[model samples]
Target: MSSRFVFSIMTLLMTLISTSSAQAITLRGEIQPDRYTYYLTDQYAQKLWAMNRDRNRTIRFNLPPGELVAQTDVSFAYQHPAPTAITCISSIYYNQGARANWLKVACIDNNGLEYSTHQKWPDTSIAKRVCKVGEASCDAFLTMSSDNWSGPQ
Candidate 1:
């Protein structure tokens, strides 16, 4: 093979590898009605396994309240504690309606610990709170409350 042809092949291979590795994996799933339990698709599980191989600490992502739906994509942020370290979710709530009606959502960690946020109309800012890290696995969903809305207003 010509030297130039060999160089071109190596460059192409390198580019392919870099491109594939740079792509991030996103996990999609739904928070079941059970509220505390969540189900992840097989693809999500596989992707999580691949991503977790390089990590030593458990990771959690604070998904936006709007994104909690029948099906949602869950992606981890760059900021995470060691897989074994303690961490929690900080939430902020704002009033999303004009009436006295309010909505509160809670995220439950693997250990049954719950972090909640309350929002009333006109208060668009998220309420903030943190729950100490619990088990190795974590999941979150909206809890049914007087202020909870069946859907986005």
Candidate 2:
């Protein structure tokens, strides 16, 4: 992705993050498809900003009151996932009354198939999402204790 594109994403993130005091915002860097690692660059308020290899989308998360993005309990369970070869991922967060804390994840699988879903932050139910996005391996959702085990759920 162009540095200008990346700069724009960072600027936008900083704007939103700076304005929100009601919720904590967490954004993830994109995966460098070739390196299979996070493409991290730029920082603000100690936060890192990045766009995916595809440079198409970005994602954010908002946790409950008093929770912080830096907290392991929160970020580990909800942050943008680590990069993988199976797919490229991006996400967005919406806050339109009643829709607050909703996160929509957009993915493009290795096959170039598109998939997306919106769910409330910090889901506490036993029902885990079962679908495929960006990654060919289905484990796109950040599951606590789950390693890089990519497989269709």
Candidate 3:
């Protein structure tokens, strides 16, 4: 084999090796109008990984140390009382006794999305979740059906 050809092959091999050894992780998660869950993976290239349900989709992600953010969608149906209130929550844990903060958006009776803060901290301090919102807890409003909530109507 020619010297130039041999050198090129070595360069390509080194590049591939470096890329594969990088420290990054992929994450997946799933969120319904009323529930959600997520998990992190081993770091791949200085990044953590997470995956969710439904989206059944995976994403390659990177975040600054001590910083985290997640986004997802949900669907819900109206009840007899109408103007139903829907509250959804999910939890996360890092170390055995690490503190983790959580933030989530809830979709209620198709009135649109509303954000809620973490009401109760889990026993582990690492896990974060939300409380339930019901008819009595939420104020009265118009109920939006699936069709009415979709597209230009």
Which of the numbered candidates is closest to the native, going by highest TM-score? 2
Q: Candidates 2 and 3: which is better by lDDT?
A: 2
TM-score order of candidates, best first? Answer: 2, 1, 3
Taking the candidates one at a time, how many backbone clashes does each contain? 16, 7, 18
* Span of 10 residues, lowest total lDDT, candidate 1: 80-89
Model 3 lDDT, residue 8, Cα: 100
| TM-scores of all candidate predictions against the true structure | 0.21, 0.23, 0.20
| Sliding window of 10 residues with minimal summed lDDT for model 3 | 44-53
C-alpha RMSD for every candidate: 17.0, 18.1, 18.1
Off by over 4 Å in 2: 1-92, 120-153
Candidate 1 regions with alpha-carbon error over 4 angstroms: 1-35, 43-66, 69-97, 109-153
- Candidate 3 per-residue C-alpha lDDT over 76-147 given as tens digits, one digit per residue, 9 for 90 to 100: 111122212322343332323344433323322223323222323122222232233333333322232441
lDDT of 1 at 4: 100
**Candidate 1: TM-score?**
0.21
69-145 in candidate 1: lDDT tens per residue?
Answer: 11111233222221211122222333345444435444432322223333311111222222222324533333235
